[model samples]
Target: MLWLYLHFPHLLLDHIRRTREETGALVIVEGSGQKVIQACPEARDQGVHGGMRLKTAISLVPELGTVRADQQQEARILEDQARWLYRYAAHIVLVPPDGLMAEIGSLQRLYGGLPAAWQTVEQALDERQLIAWPGLGHTPLAARLIARAGKGECTDDKGHIQRTLGQMPLLAAEFDARTCTRLQRLGLNTLGEVFALPAAELARRLSPETLARVQKIQGTRPDPQAPWQPPHHFRQQADFVQEIEQSQGLLFPLQRILAELEEDLCWRQQETDSLLLVLQHRHEEPSRLRIRTSGPEHRAEAFLNLVRLRFEQHPLRAPVMSLQLSVKRFLGREADTGQDLLGESQDLNEAWHTLMSRLQARLGDQALQQLSPQADHRPERAWTASGVQRNNRPAATMNDQLPRRPLWLLQGPQPLTEAPTAWFAGPERISGGWWDGQRVHRDYYIAQLHNGQLAWVFRDVRDGWFVHGWFG
Candidate 1:
C-alpha cells in the first residue's frame, strides 16, 4: 500500500498564527514557560529558535508573542486537520502532536495519479496557511520517518523509498537513546548500514518492539492503521490571535469556514436550511446568531450574504476571540431547481429565495407576511396572514370558482349616497357567520360608479346599499 505522511513541525504556532492579521515574531513556549519549543519564520529572522530560553527570545525580539503549549489543544487541532484530509482519502491515521498519514493506494484511480493526490493535499495545506512536510513510501512508518526527518519527497517507487530510508541518520529513525547507543558502538551510523545486517542477527541484538518497528518501516511486516471517520454533524471553528472587536472583522475567517461548509455539503450531496453561528468572547457570554434560509440551501455565497445582513442588523455585543459555525439539521438533496436545456439555471426559485431571504434579513422575520386563503366566507376574513416562504400559494387558487371579489377591499362598508352609472357582473348572494356573533345576509354586485371607479356594492337585506370595496 502507498502511504502519504504529512509532518507538521509547528502545528501549535501555525494554529495560533492563522487567526492573526499581522505578521510578527511568534513562538510556542513549553508548558513551563521557560523554553521555546517552536518558532515562526519571523521569530527565526529575529534570532529566535527552538530550545532557546524565553528570556533570550524576548531579548532578540522584544515584541515577540508567545503561546504556551497544551497537549490537549494540539491534539484537537491535529484532529481538525485530519477532518480536512478525510475529504480526500478514506484511510487516515492520526499521529499525535504533529503528523497525519493516509493510505492513497485506493485513491490512485479516483484522483488520477500520485502526483494529483499529492498536489491536492499540498494545495489544501497552502490554502489553510499551514506548514507541512509531505513524504511518500510503501509503508506508513517509512513515510512518517522520511517526513519527520525533513527528507520528504513525492515518489511512490519502492527503490527510491528504500534509498531515502537507508540514508536517514540513526537518530532520525526514532529509536530509543539506548538502542542508538548500542548501534553506535557497532559503528552503524546510517540506517543503510544497520539494514545491511542479517535479519536474525539484528533481531537478536535489538528489542522485539524496535525490531518490529524496523521491519514495518522496511515493509517486511504489516502495519494496520485504523481509519478516521468524520462526525455525523459538521462543526468547524476558527481562532483569532487578535480579538475581533467589530462584526465585520469576523467575516474574513467566517468566509473560509463557510466555503469549507459548502464543500462538505457538496461532498455529502445534501443541503441544510439552518446554520448556527457562535461567537466566543474573552469575558462575556458568547453571542449566538441563528441563520435560517427559506429553503434547503448549499451555496456558500447565499449563506454568506444572509450572515452579512444579519450582522448589519445586530451589532457585536462583545469582542470575539473565536468563531464557530455548525449545522445540525441535514436536509435531503434538493431537486434540480430551474436548469434550462443549456445547463444554465433559470434561477426563478433561486431569485425568489434570495429576495425573501434579504427581505427577512432587513426586516424582522415577523415583518414580512404572506396572504393565505382562510375558510371564512366574509370578504374581509377570507385570507389570513402567514409567514413568507420560498413557495407561495398561487393567488388564483384562493376562492376559485367563486364569484370574483375586488382585489382591494375597504376596511369597512360605506353607504352609497349616489346611484351607479353602470352595473357590471354581479348579484352574488353571501350568507354566513351565524356560528359566530355576527351574521351577514347580502347581495353583492360589481358596479361602475360616477367617478369611473368599479366598486363592489352590496345590498344588506336588513340595511341599505353600501360600497364594500374597489377593483383594481
Candidate 2:
C-alpha cells in the first residue's frame, strides 16, 4: 500500500496568525510558558526562534505576541485540516497534534498518478496558508519519519524509498535516547548500518517494542490505522490568547471560521438558514446569538455581513475569551430560480435575500413585519400586522375574494361635515364584531364629498355620519 503523510511544523501558529490583520511577531510558547515551541517569520526575523527561552524571545521583540501551547487546541486544528483534506482523499488517518496520513494508492487512476494526488494536497495547504512538508512511503511510519525530517518526495520506487530511509540517523528513527546513544556508542550511526546486522543479532540488541517499530517501518508487520469520517454538521471555534474587550474585535476571528463554514457548505452542496454563535466571557455567562437569514445561504460574505449587523445591534457585555460557531441544521440547496439553465444570467432571488438579510440584521427581526388579512370584514379589522414570512411559493390569500378595497386604508373614522353629491358604488354592509365585544352596526357607502373628494362614509345606527376612509 502507498501512503502520503503531511507534516505541519507550526499548525497552531498559522491558525492564530490568520485570524488577525496584524503582522507583529507572534510565538507559541510551551505549555509551561517558559520556552517558545513555535515562532512566526516576523518573530524569527527579529531573532526569535523555536526552542528559545520565552524570556529571551520577549527581550528580542518587546511587542511579541505569545500564545500558550496546548495539546487539545493543536489536535482540534489538526482535525480541521484533515476535514479539508478529506475532500481530496477519503482514507485519512489523523496524526494528532500535526500530521495526516492518506492512503492514495487507490486514487492513482482518479488523479492520473500518485504525484498528481500529492500535488492536490499540496495546493490545498498552500491555499489555506499552512506550512506543510509532505513525504511518500510504502509504510505509514516511513512516510511520517521522512515528512518530519522534511525529506519527503513523490516517488514510489522501493529502492529510492529504502535509500532515503537507510540514511536516516538513529535519532530520526523515533528510537529512545538510550537506544540511540547505545547504537551510537557501538558505531551504528544510521538506520542502514543497523539494518545490516542479522535479524537475530538486531532482536537481541534492541527491546521488543523497538524491534516491533522497526518491523512496522520495514513493512514486515501490519500498521492498521482507522479511517476518519467527517461529521454531518459543521462546527468550529477560535480561542484567543488575549481577551477581546470590544465586540468588533471578535469579527476578525469569526471571519476565518465563517469562511470555513462556507467551504464546508459548498462542498456538501447544501446551505444553512441559521447559525449559533456563542461568545465566552471570563466572568459573565456565555452570550449566545442566533444569526438567521431570509433563506438558505452558503456564502461567507453574506454570513459575515449578518454577523457584523448582529454585533452592532448587541454590544459585548464582557470581554470575550473565545468564539464558537455551530450549525446543526442544514437545508437542501434550492436551484437558482432566477437564472437560465445555461448559467448565463444569475438568480434575482439571491440578490433579494441578500438585501432582506442585511436589513433584518440591522433592524431587529421583530421590527420588520408583513401585512396579512384577518377574518373580520371591517376595513380596520380586516388586516393585521405580523412577522415577515419568506418562502418560495406565493402567500396563501384569504381576503382576495372580499369586496374591492382601497390600497390606502384609514386608521380611524373622521366625522363628515357635508353630504355627498353622488354615489358610484353601494352601501356594502360590514357589521359584526360582537364576538370580541367590539360590536359594530353601521351602513357604509362610497360617495363624492361636496369638496370633490372620493370617500368611504359610514352612518351608525344612531344616525351619526363619519368618513371611514379615502380612495386614492
Candidate 2, run of 10 with poorest lDDT? 338-347
lDDT, candidate 1, 1-472, per-residue tens:
9999999999989877876767888899999999999999999987999999999999899999888888988888898899889989889999998999999988989899888988999999998899999988889999999999888887788898899999999999999999999999999999988888878788888777777888888989898888888777888777776678898888887888899899889988899988999999989989988898877889999999999999999999988888989999998886675774445564877787788888887787899898866778888778788887754333464445665778888888999989999998769888898899678889899999999999999999877999999998
Q: Write the per-residue lDDT of candidate 2 for residues 94-160, one digit (tens) a residue.
A: 9987899999888899999887888888898988899999998999999999999899988999999
| Native-referenced Cα lDDT, model 2 | 0.87
All candidates' TM-scores?
A: 0.77, 0.79
Q: What are the clashing pairs of model 2?
A: none
What is the number of backbone collisions in each predicted candidate, taken in the order shown? 0, 0
lDDT of 2 at 321: 84
After superposition, which runs of candidate 2 have C-alpha atoms over 4 Å from their true positions?
A: 181-187, 239-241, 337-346, 371-387, 392-472
Q: What does the lDDT read for residue 194 in candidate 1?
A: 81
lDDT of 2 at 91: 94
